[model samples]
Target: MGADELSATLWRGRRQLDFLLFLLETQLLHLRAGNWHRLNFTASELEKVLENLRFESLARGVEATALAKEWRAPDQFTLPALVEIAPPGVWAELLDEHRRALVSLVKDIDGAVAANISILEKGPDEARAGLDDIEILATQVNIERALAAVSEASLPFLRDFLGLS
Candidate 1:
């Protein structure tokens, strides 16, 4: 389901926690299928997505606290602003060789989505004329969709620490 269709049951503060945990479990299915997804949001969109989170009161740099490492208490930022900043050093993180492996995995998911859209828009007959590898295409599409859903329901590190959800 897209953002527009998300019900209050799914988005309410408490239920959202449980939903995120459920999402983490569901992601196991995608992992088994060798699928991973990357979330690429513009600064503004990222801000909007995290606006409701309780990160502000949370102490920064509390392990898994990327924001804390590079920032301080007096230096405040809105969710949108933090999205633009992308939690600490976005560029440095991308530059890491080890992290590149993770990037590649997520890139595969994004590529699958682009392929699916192309197939639908250009019509299956034309898109799959030569490389009509239906099985491979279908697998990628299914895995990609599952990963995207999990990405949307991602949880905070705090939840795990508090044993909340």
Candidate 2:
């Protein structure tokens, strides 16, 4: 893929990550407030976001594969690999930094999501069985906040990559 194509692809992926972080934040609020009604709605929203993230990831994978092929790199090579292998350039370094931050946020979100799933798997019955939903909810909120902060930090790099004024 060409530079512009790569930029657009990364832009789309970054936006997907942003929206995913937003959905998770909203879900955290619902969990924290113990609003079962809102939680159900927000959970559905998260499901949709997760689906979108999946498709975006797939599209990015295709683009990255094309980029790797363009450079004659190994099939397993990815965008970050491209940056590391190629000579230092302004955009490449910026993209690599942003990607690393984005990846860290994803890991945080993933951990929070797994914890939320564990709480969910216990069910309402487990709440009666002495599971501290409030504590779990609080932990969930904190975890999500960390992810939101990371997403916020990534905004500048994303805008730069997209060539936004």
What TM-score do all the candidates reach, one by one? 0.26, 0.65
Query: Which candidate number has the best TM-score?
Result: 2
Model 2 Cα lDDT, one tens digit per residue, 78-148: 55666765544665776576567666666656655655554444433433345477765754554454333
Alpha-carbon RMSD, each predicted model: 15.3, 9.4
Full-model lDDT for every candidate = 0.35, 0.56
Which candidate should be chosen as best, given lDDT against the real structure?
2
Candidate 2 achieves a global lDDT of 0.56
In model 1, what are the clashing residue pairs, if there are any?
47-80, 61-68
lDDT of 1 at 152: 41
Model 1 TM: 0.26
